[model samples]
Target: MQKELLKWLKDVGELDSARLISECSVDLLYVDTLFEMSSDRMTDLMDAQIGIPGKYYLKLQLDFQKEIKIIETQLMEVATALGMHIRSISWNPKIDTDKEVQMKISIIVRQAIFDEITLNKISWSGRLEEPDFLNRIFDLSKMPSFDSRFDNAYDDIHKHRIMNYDWEDDWVFTDRRFNLLHCEEEIFLKFLSLTINPVSRTDDEGVGQLIEIYNRNLSESGIEFYEKSKIAGKPIYGYREIAAGNASTSSADAKQRKIALVVGCSQYEFAGLLENPLNDAVAIKQNLESLGFDVMYAENPNLKDLKIKIDDFGTELEKYDVGLFYFAGHGVQVKGLNYLIPVDANLKSERTVEYDCVQVDRILSHMENAKTSVNLIILDACRNNPFERSWGRDLSQRGFAVMDAPKGSLIAYSTSPGKTASDGEGKNGLYTGELIAEIKSVNLTITQLFQKVRKAVMEKSKDTQVPWESTSLTADFYFNRK
Candidate 1:
């Protein structure tokens, strides 16, 4: 790329004639006026070196003695005009002497410039602004304090295009630009976005079809499975996984054969609804460990912390043959995307919902990539959000729903999509109570358990609240049926 740029530079004009300064250095300089610079100043900074017929390059730099905030403000303006956006920033600090700091700064700036030029949405014409005079305004308050701001700034720099993308384009960020910015021969390029294509996903509709399958197969033991009953210590058909695995592993000194993660959130501020999903998590953990499965539990994890936990679990997932993720909490479907809420989630806006809450797809991505042979996700989170209650939205809205569970995975929801589940007045949820009953029964596959749970919940709720399941299991699995 540099070779091409150098060649392009030689053809346009004399190197010194265009006020071009190659490898220019600055000292004790600070740039504070970048935020308030006019458009002409930016034009001046463009250094006006034409490239490849009509293209241009702007060599920009922010020095150590300059205020990062000022530099950021100026960059944003240029990015907006040029139809560029910032994506992210990864920085390494220099703790050595002043000279080392300066050298590191130059390297960082040069690398950033190279990256920007090579980026699909941006082109480097030349040094539009001088680095020498611009480095003197080092006001410190313009820098960001948190990592998110810096990351956002970089994202903005990389992303700020005037146009949206086309449907046929690859959605992968690394493959192509999300925005289009091309220069016409007359320099009449306008960053205009194309219309967005409608989303074609209809998986939510499939949940209803799945419900019919369960209702049709409700009574007969189409696939025999069950939880153990306490009174007779006999296995009953349709037990949840945690119960069977927990019971068998109890007395054995050997490591538990399977591991389960139970996540729950109940203390919703708007409605003040509480079912103690955490308490259920504790119960499930203890009972599962007793039966032979190593149980790990997290209750109402902060939204900020959930991803870290998920990532950590992703690594540990390879350790077990079977991986189970169970979530019981409030869920909401927004803009066609499903979000699992943390106790701290405050989604006042649709955009906020997408970023802060855990997306159903992200969880699937981790699980599908995991090496575990069996991946089971059990969600009992179908409570309604209080903030949207007054908006006249359906109260029957179920929590998050997932589609297309991978070939080795099973996804069970507490209630059908677009329907709400009841928080049992009893110790556990109605579905969980039945789940606890069935899991104690040995020799049940997850498919059978889900089918049975669908039956029990439908029957127990008088056909009002139906459970849902999506599975692509390739092998039979049992906690204690053997």
Candidate 2:
């Protein structure tokens, strides 16, 4: 039986030479039981001549399960170290039985990595190779015994469009290779179902009926199918259409209508003014404009004027798919509520801040209420509090307070909550300077962009300042998608 199983594995190219030998070895202690049972009867003597195939088959399945689990654990550790998210890793035992277990693992890579793979046409044949970061995590060579079921589903989905439609409206349909690399859940599952039980012409009545029943059930529970699919796969990062009003526009038009509001308050009437805010704001505005945003630049606005501009910004957000707001100035937190102070504010007491300053929640409310698909708010407002000494009151906090991010929105601070950020000795602040450089990087997702920025800021500040962010975004976002 062991020889037969080894031959079968070799013919299928499932297990490598090293693993096959390790899995086939049986313990000598179990063979003693068979020898002792031979004296019972003639039938028992005949049975002893040939080993039990079922026992050996069950043992092989257990060995495969153990090896696959080890591989999965190693892949997970590598992915976590690289700051990647793995949505699912599973092996199916029903379809191929012990001969070849079907395995599927889905991971969401940064845009840079994804683009490199797509452009270079990298094939993951279960071997560790170049692009060492990805290879380290997804070493397919370790699990050569398991068939990559998801890869076949990805290939089939690429060849056939969903429901025979040409997919002119979907951005993923533009390139077959791109589509295969970043396929959504519903499409992959549809192809997987078809692959498992293909429709054939010479099928018997029972097989045809079973296929019909499967199709009928799939169609009947469409909502449930999509929900289940979402729970299993990695989140997609492609350009999704605006849900509320601009759903009919072309992709090019949607990309062109991106809007940003850039505000920098430096020239203060009552408090000591900072030198780098204006430079930081201008640099940020220029970078954003280069990335195709129609920026509304504001320099040193008063409290009432800032409110007016914010109201106008909220109105403009309705017209765009992506809305970003950036502020570089002084801010304070009073009684656990964060406030962005204007240039003309006169803070006599803690109670006066409520009326003199703009609440951080106001900006978040506008974003949460807007029809935009993605909203980003960056505040480089963590400089040392100018009002702390003048007011002669200990606010119990030095810098900006932490705030939770609304759904579909992200809030990024120049430094961590309650920590002061340094206005750099150069033209721009440390956080904004690093951010401007990272934003120009090719194919960086929002999370990856911040990770790079955080690293640079920490290094430049010599571990004194650490940037922080709060995100509740469900889908992936990229600053530079191409």
Candidate 3:
């Protein structure tokens, strides 16, 4: 879904940042310190009236009705669909931000845009003259926009809103002449969903043919589509990876010194217990050590021990040219910052986040202090613990926030930002399993290694989990280089 649309509201004065979370709720931050307000601005804010979700603003009853309306207007401009709504505007009365601190403005959009739009992912790029998939599945000639004889003003007006106007080209044969052969990944998946949807097309025959065609040609690429579920005897489809990993014995040469800190937290006291992290860590440690890394491994460490190990890892990293750190456990993003939960973490509520868990930024800071030339931070810590949702509707985000890899470093997440990766049924989690196998490849750069792992994870998890990376490394790195 178009989560980026919420940014338009930032144009409204005094808005510091806007975030869209899992529940489709929009949380806005209004920092009093960042920008200057009018001399009587605080007085006006105190006098304002917020009509919808009661008149509570930072321990004071302030009428913010005027400000809320502007935000709602901006929401309408971005969300084109009919279902989106501003269910309520909630501000906790306990917070007293009067002393020039950031004001948290909470807004709930029921049946949020992202929730409404769920698209299955399958990768494909064809070399055909026309989109053969579309030719076989759809009869676009039936659409009103198909005819080139008429120039409708309404259609013209709609076309101009987009950056490139040849979209869904009903008339001339531009790149859009074919059905989604040339389109954004989102649009492509949307079209693919429509093709297999029981309501969209009653004919199961076309869906069958499409799957057969896809698999026959895409087998070498390791992609396959299959029936995920059935609706009233009609089939619903999803795709998965179908290939095996190639084995490699060669490890990185000893020209450059390398060290790795690997931590896996599986054992837990009450909640957030995971199955495969311990196994994942052991496997990674073996792999890194074989590849000439001085591995400092920890499994099921409590909060105190986890911090001590990380600190020590940083201190010892000074002797190495390239350093790597990997964690496999429960992780959450409170507000926008990421926290890696130790096995002993008792995350009861939002307030306990800072005290109970380790901030990923702190780890980055430790790495920065060492001044390591090349650093890699791999986190396979995004298993959606049941307690995370039980705590509160809006509290405890699902996964890690996308972070910029520090200079000379690359940050690889087990799953994409704002999404959780699957805790696997096998010895390791779905992401770490792929990562373990892919790192064995010779001469593949750190960037290439992660991309291959991302593809494998997407295939294995049926697009539910895709790994992500942010890199700023100047030189190439590998497990085994030529």
Candidate 4:
């Protein structure tokens, strides 16, 4: 890329910085006023003799000792923005002119052009200012704290138009000049990507946090900033356009919009207490959290409080793209409706038990109301209801009623409808234990994730318990995609 940029620069022979800016349509608004003045100071900076078109070299005074690093970095940026490369900066030395003797540092460089991909490959779509994403950037760019970052971005991507333009509070007076606020999508994305790079962030925590904030908005435009790798615990960020319905591996991490809620009702008040529900909830919660979900966990929650948590979770789900609900406890089915027994339930009779317990459909209702991109409802509560003996119910079905999964949802059952699932002799239930194990595997989509769990459970249970899923999912999903 640097070679090509240099070649492009060489083609435009004997060019001055002003001409380069005007021809290339660079944006100069982001440049510091004093530095912009220097660029404007044609007599000292842009004169052809000093900024000579020979193997990329820069000539600067050695007087500003303290600001030397700052000035050198900025000048190199100007050199770069003008499609030129200033390779190295050497100390001042005696110059041999017929009538003068002075010291001036010389840095060799080659002419350059902005990357072709950044300049012409991607055409401008809508106005760059149309998205609110830039609002944060614009505000931050003007702050004193962010000077270290925006300084590099400004000089790295400046443009030329009128040789002398007015100024307003550091803004270029001529709106006609190309500026950061009204550049192409390519430049906007490239500029933003540079700001979040580990080198640009001064090894601060801002890179990670900013990437999260940027990706949330960038994804709406079919692009995202991803952590390409890490350097000393800091993320090295990059950007790419994402295909529709197919998010990248970086999209599968915590920066994306995803959340989970896990509940366990083991400590019963009037119903038979179970052992593995709490354990199962913890297992699922841990796995989901590890897979980049903001998991909300509930243990031994009562009907009233659980309902409130469900409502809150639903409201919160509005802000996320994916939502998951996992429940493990004693469950009962009557008249083809499933109920999850709460720790505070009083199941005196089959008729009133519906009022005492939590309905499975209520959870689905909240997920749907939130309008999430995907919803997962996993039920490990297909246990025998102790009330069946007292009610004298003698049907073949012993567990939850069968139902179809809703649109954009995938519901998982610990056992096929109307079958019982063992709470297990170990810390976790037979179904949840396998599910957690499979969730740790990367590149497994939602359906594939459950299929593996079903197989694992089937083998472990010796075909006594078969996990099942009902999915109406419109897009593929991964718990830990790579």
Write model 4 residue lDDT over 41-73, tens digit each, in one string.
Answer: 321122111222222224333333433444344
Q: What's the CA RMSD for each of the models?
A: 25.9, 20.6, 25.3, 20.4
Task: Give the lDDT of residue 6 in candidate 1.
Answer: 30
Please estimate how well model 3 matches the true structure, expressed as its whole-model Cα lDDT. Answer: 0.61
> How many clashes show up per model?
59, 2, 5, 10
lDDT of each: 0.50, 0.60, 0.61, 0.61
For residues 290-314, what per-residue lDDT tens digits would candidate 1 score against the true structure? 6677666777788877777777777
| True-structure RMSD for candidate 1 | 25.9
Model 4, residue pairs in steric clash: 21-160, 26-159, 27-159, 55-109, 56-108, 56-109, 56-110, 57-109, 83-112, 84-112
Off by over 4 Å in 4: 1-255
Pitting candidate 1 against candidate 2, the one with the higher lDDT is 2
How far in Å is the alpha carbon of 197 misplaced in model 4?
46
For each candidate in turn, the TM-score is: 0.47, 0.52, 0.50, 0.49
Residue lDDT tens for model 3, 82-165: 222333344333323346222121111211211212222221212221233343444534333433643542343234323345
lDDT at residue 311 of model 2 (Cα atoms)? 86
Which of candidates 1 and 3 reaches a greater lDDT? 3
